[model samples]
Target: MADIAQEAGFRKNQKLKDALLQHKALSRQGFSERLFGLLFSGLVYPQIWEDPEVDMIAMELSDQHSIVTIGSGGCNMLAYLSRSPKKIDVVDLNPHHVALNRLKLAAFRHLPGHGDVVRHFGMDGIRTNSKSYDAFIAPNLDAATRAYWDKRSIAGRRRIEVFDRNIYKTGLLGRFIGAGHLIARLHGIDLTQMAEAKSLREQRQFFDARIAPLFDRPLIRWITSRKSSLFGLGIPPQQYDELASLASDGSIAPVLRQRLEKLACHFPLRDNYFAWQAFARRYPKPEEGTLPTYLKAENYRAIRDNAERVTVHHASFTELLAQKAAGSVDRYVLLDAQDWMNDEQLNDVWSEITRTAAPGARVIFRTAAEKSVLDGRLSPALLDQWSYLEERSSELNLEDRSAIYGGFHIYVKKA
Candidate 1:
């Protein structure tokens, strides 16, 4: 574990090392930019970093063309299908994500039907809802996933037991919130009630009065900005460039605080489901507000049937691009995967994207910083082919529910 942690960029800080060794600290919150990709390749993440809704908005996809995207947790790919795309390809390096995607598909196809499937996945992940899991999902899982469910944790808890235990509450993002929970606890603020706040004004007051000050503390800022700290969040060595681009000097925690503050203060807690998922561990009830369309029970069949357009690949974006015809894909969604690539890898990806694009083919992606990845990365020849929809991207960005990514850029493939 020490080697694993250090390989992920954890410096040999005695306090952190001791904590990590004892299982008391589980995050690599402030790891440096260079070490992230190596650390995260297949070890920790079950999902990708960018939000899928944002990708769909930026891509402006149509059913006329095929869609290619990183699978991540496979959430957004399914979310994309909700738009009626002709086809969708979901690719990832992680087997865990592949397995999870299959699980979602199985539930969609076999569960006691749509509403039950929605309740199982999109609900609060609690509330004693064992009907769908037992009646349909558990019996339909593939052999490997079934075996995974059969295993037990070190504490002797069955893997499937996570449904009741709320695995939804402990993903990469979930763990980040858990860290914030610990930090908030240290400051004597019980954030769970922030969800009950009625208006943005009250929300702002809470952030200004309670959360903002946490960033001002020297110890907290120093610890959080360090490269060694972010590992606990499960960001791999390759993806650090995306995170570093979020701030000018490459500080992470301050931006994190700002985003969480925005999530809590920019919208009423009752209407913000992402905030509810993070802080309150529940979805907003229908009487309170709305959820993502994919979260609704009615969308299950479309999601399950659309699995044909969705293909999961154990490959990189560039590798898949090689198979696509020139100007073939009408829309492409690269979910910040380029940030994990070195110079050579990035060039290969963009060159292929440029080659395969049709006159109206649109390529969309999010980066860690406010600027586009093509700025200093792609060559002039390759970059000049597409029309940059900066203004349009920004307009669509306002509607994106996934508030995590930095900037959305859409490029129309040159005719």
Candidate 2:
């Protein structure tokens, strides 16, 4: 919104780095489920990685290239297959994310047809998607998963009803908007479109003139500036550093507000599919929407086309790399995963990458800082064999939807 929030006056701040260092040094760092508790405690899930729609437009993917990604919430994998990659191999250490990925694949492969599929997932405007749980998905899940889905909420509503009541509740970005809406209501701002406004220009103007100013408030800004406040958006320990670095003087709230406002306020409500998922909690009607990648009617056929290229293992990144042939992978989407690793661990990941990267292999990753986390920590010889495109890196970052990642980087293996 404001020249990409990287204006000259904004100094790259390191307080988040200082804060993370202390957090990392603590005993039993990142081990407790309590940390993840912040992620799912509310009725909603946090979001990272903007929607894949815009970024996928840039890839110009072919039938030949294979993809490997972390299966965070599984939205993007289905989105990628919409373009028909040869294979999409998603890996995640978190069982919840893996289960969700599996569920999405299972739904696509097995769900009866587009309208029913859309109604099952796209209902409740996405905010009330839990209703579809009772109607469609819950019955389909195995006993354990069904039990989890059928669990009751404190409000006494079955979690399954959340589909009808909360399609917008699925991921982090939606929750952030919900939180923002709550905060806005507390301040007497009505963000709903039906309340007023006749034209799109009036809508954006209203946001610019009335709604956006609240971000300048001391309390809201202060609360959002802290590193912990962002865990709700699934800003794992690794991405916070880069997110904090985005602001001048380490004030991240303004930048976050700008990008998020873009997600919320910039486009028409119905046409904005991400917002449908985030705000209304439903997929647009067939004429009103283009469903996310995994939800498409064509996905089963698309993913099934290249299914053979992938191999799934119940393992971590390092463990899985150990089993792969050298120089075999082409694209790697490590979504905020390296933050879990310290120096030694990162080196081991890099060693595997160096050994496994084919000539001209492109490795892309998002991080919490503008600087490469692997730079100083990696062996000089290993780092020297690659090309880093700083300017091109900036371009690739342009239309990313999740509005959460701070830095986008790409490294190419030399021939």
Supply the TM-score for candidate 1: 0.83
Worst 10 residues of 2 by lDDT: 2-11
Candidate 1 stretches greater than 4 Å from native = 1-52, 125-131, 232-253
Clashes of each: 26, 41
Per-residue lDDT tens digits for candidate 1, residues 1-415, read: 4346434433433322321231123344322433443344322433344556667667776667788787766667777777778877777655556666766667667766666655666665465545556667778776787775666666776555555655556545556667767877887878777766677888788778877887777767777766656665564444444676666765677777766676667666665667676667656777766665566656666777775666676666777889988877778888766655556667888888888777788888876556677787788888888789889878766555446656677888767
Residue 197's C-alpha lDDT in candidate 1?
A: 68
User: How well does candidate 2 match the true structure in TM-score terms?
Assistant: 0.76
Cα lDDT listed for each candidate: 0.65, 0.59
Error of 1 at 299 (Å): 2.8
Worst 10 residues of 1 by lDDT: 15-24
